[model samples]
Target: MTGESLVYVAWAAQQMNARRDEFIAGLVLVTRSEIRSLDHDSRMVDLLNASITENVVAAIHFLEHGGVEADVEAPTAALVYARALAQRDVALSALIRAYRIGHGRFVDEAMALLAAQAPPEKALPAARELVHRAASWIDTICDRVGITYEQERDRWVSSRSGLRQHWVNELLSGSAVDIVKAEDALDYRLDRNHVAAIMWAEDTVATRDVGDLFDGARSALGEALAASGPSLMVPTDEREARLWWPADRIDCAGVQAALAEREVSVRIAVGDVGYGVDGFRRSLREAERVKVVALSGGPASGRVTCYEIVAPIALMAADVGDLRLFVQRTLGALASDDERSESLRDTLREFLARNGSFSATAKAMFLHRNTIQYRVAQAMDACGVSFDDPDAIASVQIALTACRWMGSSVLRQTNPTP
Candidate 1:
């Protein structure tokens, strides 16, 4: 190309650089809309936007400077994004497609600038040089990012954590696999009595160091449970992990004390103890169910929830909305979110739990018999139920249980007074 053509090409590249924000926005918008998998979550979307910005900046630099034959170093953000996509199990083709689409758009924009700004003779030659350079840059960058993706994927799959997670998933899925081989690979037996716990941070809790949180929880659980054999931990994501101890019993109080002592920020949902491989799978499922209940109830559900305590509510956790509606419908004004209503419901629930014994309910609630009687009468009046009817009694009991475990979720959302 002539010096005049090179000058026009440089001007077009500079024009793109000047409109860098526009280019990056358009590219990210197109990529996100076209490749759904790439836009999985907020974190991924941020990564994608950063990666495109870096790539566009680098591509514009490449065009302005004549570095066609030299090695292309992909922007750090771009490489990091590629590795993240690989870790997330996104297809490499998706990454390559994003590159090609962006390249085409970049070349098209450059051609448009050359057409608008350059003389006719300069525009064609400059457009050709611009396209060639853009194509070369994409080819090199894609090759590097592609290699990065594959290498990360390989390393992630072959890593010890990865293999262990694989086996856990297989077991969780209830697929028939050789238990002996799975045990050998995991280095944790599936034949023993196990207590599984699903541990995760509350969204409100900032997890500065996931490794430390998980390690501390493990050590605390092992020491608290007094486990003789090895324990297993499999991370489900950056924020959550599954843990199991080879113990027939899990003292929920002890576990809570241990977590408090260590100041671990994660909440734990534990399963009832179960034996053998089937028990292993069962224990994990139970923990998962307990975790669901705990999450639905939020922090008010407490930091450590065990299947033994929350099993009744866990069964209904799959449809909390429906269950919430039921609680409100059954409890009536008693389900109102207020101190007075809550006190009434608590007294009535205890009264029923103690089999209509006002004295026992008073003993349990640390209130006098007259107070329990008055509150029970108030709650019964609010519920508009007759204890004489068995169905009303049953429904009231169930609603109270839902309220106790589900907390405010199953309670009526009453507006506060102005």
Candidate 2:
């Protein structure tokens, strides 16, 4: 290349270095759809960003140095990224397409820069050289990265835990695989009745100590379920674990007692007991659903919540907007956060629970009979419904339960009357 051509190539490289972020943003925008389909893991996303930035910088360096020898090794960042992506199981086609799209965009930018800095005759040849250089470098790096990806993928497939996790994930996703084969791979019986549970750290501060917390939870759970039968616990991440044991073997009371005795900060959600292969999958799904509700119910809901008990509230509150509306309509002014309203609501809950027996409610709440009657009457008046109507009573009961479980933060009036 002549001195003038070298100047144009150098200038193009300078332009890329100066606006590196803009170039990367543009490339990402164009390839966003492909990238989204790769994997949702946070680590994979970080690798994608780092890989793009590093590749662009390396390309600029190659161009500035007059297209180095073909024997140069692939960029260290690209090789590392390829291995990471393979371990994450991203499709090879998606990885290759990202490179193709990125290089095409880089070539367009280089051409534009050359046109802006040189006359037409000089610019056309310089643009051709830049395209050749960029395309050749991309092809060489893709070959190296692709080879690394395949090797890493094969290694992952042959690992013991990898095979176990793969079968577990397949089972959970309802794939039609031989149960016997899956059992053999997992080393856990799927033919027996199962009760699934999920244990997780509740907060970021607690998450930092999750490894110890998970170990403590595992030990506690193992001891609790020992009498029931064999059990299995798998770590889904640093802060979360999934566990299962034979439904017939689990001592619910024992598990609860053991969990209470644990010193670590953790939450456990247990599914209804289910039997056999279908039951195994179903129980895990139910446990996950119940876990979401447990977290939403706040800390006062306790460390362990059974699926059977929470299913009603969890299903009812799934559509948050509708749940809020139902609460507002059923409780009316009682849903407000005033002391009087809360007191009346509590009195009504106890009165209903005691089957509308004023004496029973008084005895249970340690209040005078006259005070119970007054509060019940006040609650009925505030609620704008007669407790004599069964439908009204049922509605009020549901509203109170929803309010208690969901907490005042969600049930509080959105628009307050002065």
Candidate 3:
């Protein structure tokens, strides 16, 4: 290297040291844009900030020393940061992107600093050398980070819960395997009556201490199924869990009452009772479907929903666009959002629910028989439906039930009536 180039490198290094905070801040912004996994993860973001600070300090030191060399006293911070991110389940792609972005930003800032501190004639060669050194340094750090990430991931995969999760995933994937061995590995019986459940916290902040939430769910579920025998629970992610218990029959009302008494805010979907291995798998599938319907129904916290009760609504609403069209076509202006229309829709719903008996509908709605008849006539007229047609009555009933389950907010988006 020329004497002039070495002098420029030293001058740039000094300037970087003086403006260390600014360099670190710029690097962090670039890295954040590239590493999307860091979003909404405060702990990971803090670790990344610390890593950037250490990296900036190290870069300044390397520039001042004029070359990169193996240093035993101060280990690279990038490797430590990688381990932390891997432990948090950040993907390898995100890590590589972060490094690439940080390297690019560092080179740009170093070149600008060099140009400002040194003569124009010397800046070009010094900038080239600095780029080479920075690239080499970043490459070495990335390699080390990759190694550390692999080690951490391997360790995590071999852990007990990790093996259980892997086994569950394989079973769910329908891979050809021995069910007996899988059951043995999971330590849960598959050859029995099973009731599947999917549980999750409604609040994101409550998911931070997921272990505590899981424990609470386990205890509550155990109490609810105390008469049913042993149960198995699996943590699916930070925010959700899948569980099942061996029971001759699921007392859904009893389970709902038990969960409602709990202090924790959890939403639970209980599947229909099924027998043996197929039952276990089917129940889980049903539970997952019920979870979607429950979420759409509204606030699910401290609520246990049984699939059997909502199955009709879930089936009809599965094709949402079609269901919305069906509702609009069946109800016409009766599906309007105005208070009068809403009241008429409710009256008609109750009237039809009573099998066209005006007395029964009046008793249910606590209105006079004439009043109930007037509303039903209004609803039928507004909807342009024939009371004599059985299909029309069935369609109107189904649409009303769907709107009740799906809520007004969902219907308002696509309702044909104003």
Q: Each model's TM-score?
A: 0.66, 0.61, 0.62
Descending-lDDT candidate ranking: 1, 2, 3
| Local distance difference test, each candidate | 0.84, 0.77, 0.75
For residues 1-418, write the lDDT of model 3, one tens digit per residue: 5766877777787887898898788778767775667652333566788877887787778877776456412245666677666554568878877778877877787799888876777789999878877777777777777888889768756776657766776777676868888889888877778888888776654547777876787677767766366677776545667888887666778788777777567778888888877788888888877766676667722378878877877666555667778888888887765678778988999988888999999988888999999999999999899988998889888888766666553355434556
| Poorest stretch of ten by lDDT in candidate 3 | 67-76
Residues 1-418, model 2: lDDT tens digits: 5766777888899988899999887776567665676533233455677788888988889888877657656777777778766655567888898999898888887888888888888998888778877878899888988998899878866776457657877888777888888888888998778889988776654546787887787778777766266667665544566888775555667777888887568888888778888888888888877765676567877888777776776677556668778887898878886668878988999999888899999999999999999998888887899866899889999888776666664466545568
**Highest TM-score scorer:** 1
Clash pairs (backbone) in predicted model 1: none
lDDT of 1 by residue, 1-418 (tens): 5667777778888999999998899899999889987865445677899999999998888778766647689999998888877665678999999999999998998899999998887788888877777888999999999999999888877888778877887787787988888999888987779998988765665557877878888888888888878799886555667888999687889988888888777888899999988888888889978877786677777888999888878887767778899888998989887889888888888899888998888888888999988999999999999989999889999998888777887888889789
In candidate 3, which residue pairs get closer than 3 Å at backbone N, Cα or C atoms, i.e. clash? Answer: none
Candidate 1: clashing residue pairs, number: 0
Clashing pairs in 2: 228-249
Where does candidate 1 stray beyond 4 Å?
1-155, 203-208
Q: How accurate is candidate 1 locally (lDDT)?
A: 0.84
Best by lDDT: 1
